[model samples]
Target chain A: MSFKDSYDIIVVGGGPAGCMAAYAAAKENVSVLLLEKDRDIGSPVRCAEAVGKDGLEKILEDNINPRWIAATIKKFQFVAPDGTVIFPQVPMTGYVLHRKLFDFDLGLLAANSGAKIVTKAYVNYLIFENDRISGVHVRINGVQHIIKSNIIIGADGVESRVGRWAGIDTTVHMKDMETCAQMTLANLPLDDDTCVFYFSQKRFPGGYGWVFPKGNKTANVGLGISGDRARSDSASARLESFVHDHFPDASILNKTVGGVPCANRLPKISSEGILLVGDAALQANPISGGGIATGMTAGKIAGNIAASAIKSDNISADFLKRYEKEWDTACGNAQKRYYRLKEGIRKLSDEQLNKTAHVLKDIPQKKQTLVKIFQTALIKQPGLLVDIMKTLNPFS
Target chain B: MILLHDNKCDFCGTCVGVCPENCIDLGEAELNIDHQICTMCYKCVWICPVEALFAEKVK
Candidate 1:
């Protein structure tokens, strides 16, 4: 698509969040432009590609395509440090997605909604007029172009520069970042419906290893360690050791590495005509580091708010503040509760984790649930007990 | 000084995200580190998943 001189809304990044923002804005009959720095919308997938089924269905509704799903997860297996296994029968189903196909479909949806889409377009910086975000200077196909927009949505991932360039404090503390590496292994024996998590401070200090089945005897095996605990070895090295020990005969197909911000959402996600979503806003789940569902939620809200503000001819920060308030009510508040639970869980020792697993193993399988497991594991953390109740409470 | 091994680098931009100085930039297929502002804190070196970045001493 040809670059326009100006657009009503410009979304920087072409991941799920950015595409949803563009799609939402364009559905409102606004001129929108979506820019992706990579050669394609979803090449070099960096995510674990897992999302809760209900969360995804809420956004896609009848539009959910079967081609985008790799595995329909039915259960979770938690392996404690001492090899004690605990089955947490989560009430809802999850899906291990084919992220490339899923993301490409979202981009297509945006295009079908009249949003212009461009790839290999790197946004260098933002343009300011009267100290308000007005446009962006981007390089496409090695050529520079200046494009103006009434509002800019920074859906860029963890390394988001758009937020930084806009003078928002997007800095993440070392401890809050999860350094991650994954390899798609084939010829592996695995259940097509179960996700496995390995918890060991010695093996994956401060984080955990995961084996998410992608169906067809293949799976994405990976591990993430907090940045503070990542000094001794690289994430790939640790993953290699884990893979070697567990899936020695499995052939490696693809290797990817990235960082996930497990911190709470940025204190300020909007300022003066600019809004940030997804990893740029640190919207991932603090405990699991999953952002697909929350990112899309925030993106949809931001896109709608941006379009309405433009219609009213008031794109000031005061008007954009509505985005933050709406996001807090939708997901940000729940995210805060999760962050607190994560803090409490982070302090559990290997022995404590093993003991918790043993305690849960004694319970009848029919009575096992996520809340019951958390209640048993965090019996001493009275403060987090309330946070867990608020976070997991169905009626709340 | 820090050196980047291009062959080993995956251009995943993990280094760019963790850099305290915010001097690294990940372009479409290239990664650049600005030595002028880098304090040699080596956060990127330690955090690189592929060990693409390393610290070097200049004579």
Candidate 2:
């Protein structure tokens, strides 16, 4: 088979969002191509690699193959700056993943569904004809090629040039951006079945640090500092200091540094013949910065819509807004409230975090329900109560 | 032509994508901007997150 000069849809990026978009769009037997800039599907791991099992299962149809799972967590531990630990026994599960393998598997599924997947194809710009997006010019293997497509899906990650080139205003505010550093460490004594989150404005101003165990003696330890606080000291330095102080004897296996956009969903996700999905559209959770499930959810919606529009021969802006409405109803509506709660919680001082833990320690063990715990922790921000409720219990 | 900041360059390669001339090549070892082929689009200067790329004198 030879490379085609044109396709029905072109997806730029090979991460989860891009793969899912290609998989969903190609399900209808339309000619689709997925372009990945990197030679490998997933080499440089970014996120903490921990995701809620229930949310992931709901999106993946409860068929998570064990091959991608690094570890399964049964409980969550919250640590305040004063050494107070609060274990929340919510009936939820967490999964620490081997991201390199998971990303490769997603790409394979996209190829199996009839989407042509290519690596090292770096998209340079969008082609315009009659003031509308026609296709993309990409660089693959030191050669430049202009690949035509009826529609373009910009599933490229944060700091996405696809959306910017299309004039979609994809800029993220510094306050809502998170600069993170993570290291996979070995020989550390950790609870493999627990996800521990540490809060201290002193160490991780405007954000937090986490340790998610991947195996019996190995773990992913990382911290994120809000962009506003990261101006002086890079996130790398902060993580290095935290790791040395907390896990002095731990040996580092791998290290990664990146940023996560923790802002509200873009006011506009679709324009003309282009649709931005996942981090490109700022679909990450505001407080948690978790985006895998959200990216898949949006990718599935955009892909199904794009293919349907191609069938009807109307890939117009008005028709594509159907995806916007559906996604807003599915996840964006809840995320609006999540953004507010994140801002309120991010401003909490280290003194307040310690005080809240002290108060919680004195409370009787029987009264420590998830709802009660959140209620007390957020008592000062009464204005955010209802939104927090919707955030904590999306089902309700 | 595009001048690079050796210290501020994090190898993000935002410039490679934004360059209209496609004169910039980001390899594993170095990010090179071929001055002979560059059209001086200056998009790379505006696109760099760290302000690592700049135009010393408009070509």
Candidate 1, residues A67-127: lDDT per residue as tens digits? 9999999888999999998988777788999999999999999999999999999999999
TM per prediction: 0.97, 0.89
| Regions of candidate 2 where Cα sits further than 4 Å from its true position | A364-366, A393-396, B1-59
Compared with the real two-chain complex, what DockQ does model 1 have? Answer: 0.75
lDDT of 2 by residue, A1-396 (tens): 357999999998888888889999999989999988778887666778878888878877886889889999887778999889876556677899988999898889889999998887888799999988999998888799999997999988875778777888776666777777788999999988988999998888888899999987899999887766665666677888899999999999988766788889889999888999998899988888888888888998999899998899999999999999999998898888878878888878888888888887787755655666667778998987787666764211
Q: For model 2, what is the error of residue A278's alpha carbon versus the real structure, in angstroms, after optimal superposition? A: 0.9
- Model 2 chain A: weakest 10-residue lDDT segment is A387-396
True contacts kept of each: 0.66, 0.01
Runs in model 1 lying further than 4 Å from the true structure: A393-396
